[model samples]
Target chain A: MRVSYYPGCSLEGTAKSYDISVRHVCRSLDIQLEEVPTWACCGSSPALKMNRLLSTALSAHNLALAERQNLSDVVAPCPFCFRRLKSAQEEMARDPALRQKVEQTIESQVNGNLTIHNLLGFLTERVGMKAIGEKIRKPLTGLKLIPYYGCYVVKPPSVTCFDDPANPTSLDEILRAAGGEVLDWDFKSECCGAGLSLSKPEKVCELTGRLVRDAAWRGADAIVVVCQLCQANLDLRQREIGLTDKKEYQLPVIYFTELLGLAFGCASEQLGLDRHFVDPLAVLKRKGLA
Target chain B: MFRLTGALSEQEFLHHVVQRSGQNLLECLQCGKCTGGCPIASEKVSGPRRLIAEILSGMRNEALKNPTWWYCVSCGTCMTRCPVDINMYQVATALCELAQEGGIAPSERDIHLFEELFLKSVEKYGRVKELRTVAAYNVITKNPLKDMDKAVTLMRKGAFSPLEILSGWAKDRKVSRIFALARRTSEGGHE
Candidate 1:
C-alpha cells in the first residue's frame, strides 16, 4: 500500500486540484505516499525540441534519487512525467552507451530498477476496483461521466507500455467501479492540444473544442480526466471555445481522483469541487451526487 | 521540379538523424498512416509520409524546411497508429532539434522561445515557477502582457500563487548539479 509518488510541476501550479484529490483519495484508501526528495521538472515536450540529452538527464536525475532512496515502485500521477520517467528507464536499459552518457551528463547513476507506473495503472492494479466499489458510500449513480485518458497516458506501447495503445479500457473500468455511468465516446484517448495553448491558443481551442463538443453531444454530464495538462487545457479554455464556436457547451471537466473522492463519501471541500473553471459542482448538484 | 545535387550531404544528414533518433527512416513503408493521423497535417504543407520520404531521399532541406515539425504536438498519435512501428513522432522531434541547430527559422517562434524559457526556468528554480516562466517568455517574445489575463484568473481561483515559486530552493543543491553536468555535456564535453 506504499509507493513513491512523483507529482510533477503541473500538479502544484495549474493542477492543484489533482494533487489535493490524489492525496485525499490515497489517504482514504490507506495508500502511503512518499514524495521524491527535491524533484525537478521532467522537461516535458519542450525539452524534446531543446535537447534530448537535457530531457533524459532531468528524468534520470529524479530516477536516480528514487533509487538512492531505495523505493522500488515509483508512481507518477501526471502522464507527462510518467512518460518521461519511463523513457529515461527504457533508454538507459536499451543503450548502454546512452546510459553511460546520461550518467556522465547528469552525474548520477540510474539503476533502472524502479517500476514506473501511471495513475490509471495504479488505481486499477494496486487499488483494485472491487475495493474501490466497496468504499463508495454514495455511488455516482445518475452522473454520466466520460473518462478522458488523453494521449500520453497510454500510447506508443514501446515507450508507455502500460495499456492497449489504440483501445484503452483501464480508465473506463475505474470509472465504472466508482459507480459512474461510463459512456462510450470516440474522443476518449484523443489529443487535447496541451502545449499549443501558449504557442497557438486558437489551435488548442479547435482541438479541445472537438473533444468537449463530442462529450456534450453524447449527453455526458461532465468529463473526468487524469492528466493535469488536459484538465487545464480543457477546463480553462472551454469557455473561450464556447464563445468562439458560439455554442452553449457547458460541460465541466473534473479530475478522476475528485470524482473518486466523491464516491468515497469525502466532503466537497476535500474534493476541490470549486477549483474547476467551468465549475462541476452545479453539474454534481444537478445529478444529486452532491 | 526537385533538385538532386547534394545527395551525399543529405545522406550524411539523414544518417545523423537516424543515429540520433534511433528510428530507421527505411523502416517506414510510406504507409501514410502517420500523415493520416497527424492533427497538424491538415494545415501543414506536408505530412509525415512526405516528410519521411524527404528525409530518406536525402532532401534534407525539404524535410527540415517544412513547418509540419514546428506544429507537431508530439502527441504520439501517429507513432502509436503506425502499423510499421515507424515512430514518426520521435523523428519529427529530431527534425525540430536539427532545425534549431541548423539556423532554420521555426515557423512558430513562440514554441522555440517557450522551450528556452522552460529549460532556463527549471534549471534555475529546480521546478517551474509559472509567473517567472511567463514573464521571461513574454519579455523576449515582445508581448510582455501575454497571458496576463489568464494568470490573474488562475490566481483568483487559487490555482496559482507566487509563494510556491521558491518552495524547492532549499533542497536544490543536488538538483542544481544535474543541470550543471548536463550543460557540460551539451557543450561537447565527453559525450
Candidate 2:
C-alpha cells in the first residue's frame, strides 16, 4: 500500500486541488503515499519536443530519486509526468548507450526497474476494485458521469502500458464501482489541446469546447477526469466555450479522486471540491449526494 | 549536415527519419487512418498522412517547412489507429528536431517559443514556475494580456500563488548538470 508519489509541477501550481484530493483520498483509502524528495519537472511536452535526451534525463532524475527511496513502485498523478517517467524507463531499459548518457547527465545510477503507474492505474490495478468498493460509504446514486482520460494516461500503447489506448475502461470501472452512472463517450481518451493553452488559446478553446459540449449533450451531471490539464481545460474554459458555441455548457469537471473521496464519505472541503472553476458542488447537491 | 533547400533520396530520408524516431516507416501502408483520427488535422494542417507521404517522396524541405508537426497535439490517436503502429507523435518530434537543426522557420513560431521558454523554466528552477513562465512568454510574445483572466481566476481560486513569481531557485542543483550534458550530447548529434 506504500508508494512513492510524484505530483509534478502542475499539481504544485495550477492543480493544487488535484494534489490535495489525491492525498486526502489516499488517506481515506488506506493507501500510504510517500512523496519523492525534491522531485523536479518531468520535462513534459517541452522537453520532449526540444530534446529527447534531456527529457529522458529529467524523468530519470526523478526515477533515480524514487529508486533512492527504495520503493519499487512510484505513482505519478500527472499523466504527463507518468508518461515521461514510464517512457524514460522504457528507453533506458531498451538502450544501454542512452541509459549511460542519462545516468551521466543525472549523475545518478538508474536501475530502470521501477514500476511507474499513473494515479488511475495505481487505484484500479494496484488497489483492486473490490477493496475500493468496500470503502464507499456514500454511493454516488443518480449522478451521471463520463470518464475523460485525455491523452497521456493510456495512449501511445508502447509507452503507457496500462489500460486500453483507444477505449480505456479503468476510469469507467472505478466510477461504476463508486455507484455513479458511467456514461459511454467517444472522447474518453481525446486530446484537450494540452500545452497549447499558452501557444494557441483559441485552438484549446475549440478542442475543450467539444468535450464540454459533448458531456452536456450526453446528459451527464459532471465530467470525471484524472488529468489536471483536461480538468483545467474542461472546467476553466466552460465560460469561453459557452460564449463561442452560444450554448450554456455548464458542466462541472470533477477529478476521479475527488468523486471517490465523496463516495468514501469525505466532505467536499476535505477533498478540495470547492476549488473547481465550474463548481461541481451544485451537481453533487442536486443528486442529493452531498 | 541536413540541407534546407536540397532534398535527400527517398531511401536516405526514410533511413534518417526512421533512425531518429525509432519508427518503421517501411511498414506504414499510407492507410490514412492516422490522419482520419487526428484531432488537429485541418485544412491548414495536413495531419500525419501528408507528412508521411512527404517523407516517402524524400521532400525534406517540404516536410521540414510543413506545419503539421507544429500543430500536432501529440494525442497518440494516430498511433493507436495506425495498423503498422507508427507513432506519429515520435515522427513529429523527429521532424521538429530536424527542422530546427536545418534552420527552417517553424510554421507556428509561438509554439516553438513556448517550448523554449518552458525548457528555460525547467533549466532555471528544476521545475516550472507557471506564473513566471507564462508571464515571460506573454511578454516575449508581445501579448501581455493573454490568458490574463485565467491567471486572475487561478489566483483567486488559490491555484496560482503570487509568491511563485519570485521562486525560481532549483531545489535540486543536479538539474544544471543534466541540462549541460544534454546540450553537449545534442550538439554532438548523438541523439
Candidate 3:
C-alpha cells in the first residue's frame, strides 16, 4: 500500500492540515506515503496561462524524476498540481517529439521522467472506499457534507482521467464511506476561480462565495474538498466576499482527508480542525462524531 | 455593421489570422458539446462553444473582442466533453491575451480589486496569506456586514482563533526557489 507522494507547494504551506491529515489517515490505514526524494512545484495554473510548453516541461521534469525512481504512480493531493502533472504526462506520452523536447527541458532543469496520480484517485481506486469505511471508528452521523470537486480533479478528462467531468463520484463515495451524508450540489465541479485567485481575487471571492453559500444553503454542515487552492478560496475568501457583497454566510471548508481522520477516530486537534477559518468542531460535536 | 464586399474566403481568413492553440480550432466540430457541458453556459453571454464557433467561422474581430471570452473560468468541462478534444479553455484564454494586447479597457473594478488583493499577498509575503488576503479584500470591498455573526460564533467556539493569522509566515527559501523556477519557465509570469 505504498505510493510515491508529491506534496506540492500549497500542502507544504497553507494546506499543511491536508498534508498532515492525509499522512495520518494513510498511515492508520496501512498505506505508506513515500515522499518523492526531491519535488518541485508543478507550475500549476500560472504556467498554463503564461506558456504551455514551459509549463508542460516543468511538470514533466517532476514526472521524469518519478520515472527515474521507478515509481510510475506519483500521488499528488493538490488539484492544480495533480491536473498539471497528469496533463503533462498525458501530453508527453502521446507525442514522442513533444516528449523529447520536454525530456530535454527536464534534463536541463532536473533529471527524470514522471507519471502522476491524484491522491483522491489513488485512494479511491487503489485503496477502495470500503477499506476506508472499515477504518472509521466514529461514524460522522448527522453531519451533512458537500463534496466539492472544484476544477482540477475532473476537468480535461483526457489528461486527468480520474472521474467524470460533469458528475464525479469519487469524493462523494469516499465521504459516504466516512459515515457522512453527501449533498448533491451543482457547485461541486464548479470553478472556484483557483488560478485566478491571485490574478482576480474579487472574482474568485465572488464565485467562491456563491459556491460556499450554495452549499450552506443546501444544508451542508461543511464542504469537503481535495484541492488546496479550492479549500483556501472557499474557506478564507468566502468571508471576505460575504462582507464585500453584503451577504452573511459561514460554511466551514474541510479537506476530505481531515474528515477521514475524524471518522477514523482521530482527535480534532490532531487533524488541525481548530486551524480552519471556519470552525467545524462544534458542528461535528453536535452530530456527536467529534 | 458594414459588410466586406470582397473579403477573403473563410479558409483564407483562418489561414491568415494568427490562430491561438490552432489545434483546438481545427478540432472543434460545432457539435455543441462544450455548450452542453459548461456549468455557466446559461449565464448572460454564451459559453466557450459559441466563442469557438465565431473564431472558426472567421469572425476574427468579434471572437477576439468578446467580453464573454474573459468570462470563462477555465473549468475544463468544455475541453473534457469536446469529441475532437478541443481545448476550448486554452482557446478562450488566448482570446483574452489578444484582448489584453489590444489595450482594451481595463477589466471591471471588481476584477481590479481582486488583482490588487492578490498582488498585495504576493508582494508582502511572496505567496498567498489566506487571512491577510481576506482581510485586505474585505477592507477594499468595504463590506463587513457579512460573516460578522459567523466570525463571532467561530471566535467564541475557538475555531476562528486569531492565531491562524498571527502564525502566517513567509514561504521558505525552497518555495522561493520553486517560484524562481516557475518564473523562468513561464517567462517571469506570476499567476
Q: In order, what lDDT does every prediction score?
A: 0.80, 0.86, 0.69
lDDT of 1: 0.80
Q: Which stretches of candidate 2 lie over 4 Å from their true place?
A: B1-8, B168-171
Off by over 4 Å in 1: B1-6, B142-150, B162-173, B187-191
- How would you encode candidate 1's per-residue C-alpha lDDT over A133-220 as one tens digit per residue? 7788888898898878888888777799877766788988888888889999888788888777777777788889989988988999
Candidate of highest TM-score: 2
The sequence of per-residue lDDT tens digits that candidate 2 reaches over residues B1-191 is 12334444755676788898898886778888998988888888898988888887788888988888888867788988888888887887788777878888888999989988888888877888787888998999898997678777667766667888886565556787789988888778844
How is the predicted docking of candidate 3 categorized under the CAPRI scheme? incorrect
- Candidate 3, residue B68: lDDT: 55
Clashing pairs in 3: A63-A113, A63-A114, A64-A112, A64-A113, A64-A114, A65-A112, A202-B114, A243-B143
Q: Residue A184 of model 1: what lDDT?
A: 91
C-alpha RMSD between model 1 and the true structure: 2.7
Each prediction's RMSD over C-alphas, in Å, is 2.7, 2.9, 5.6
**Winner by TM-score between candidate 3 and candidate 2:** 2
Interface RMSD of 3: 5.0
| Candidate number that wins on DockQ, 1 or 3 | 1
| TM-score per candidate, chains pooled | 0.93, 0.95, 0.76
Candidate 2: lDDT of A116?
90
Error of 3 at A203 (Å): 3.1
Give a tens-digit lDDT track for model 2, residues A120-158: 999998888989999999999999999999999988887
CA error at residue A125 for candidate 1, angstroms:
1.3
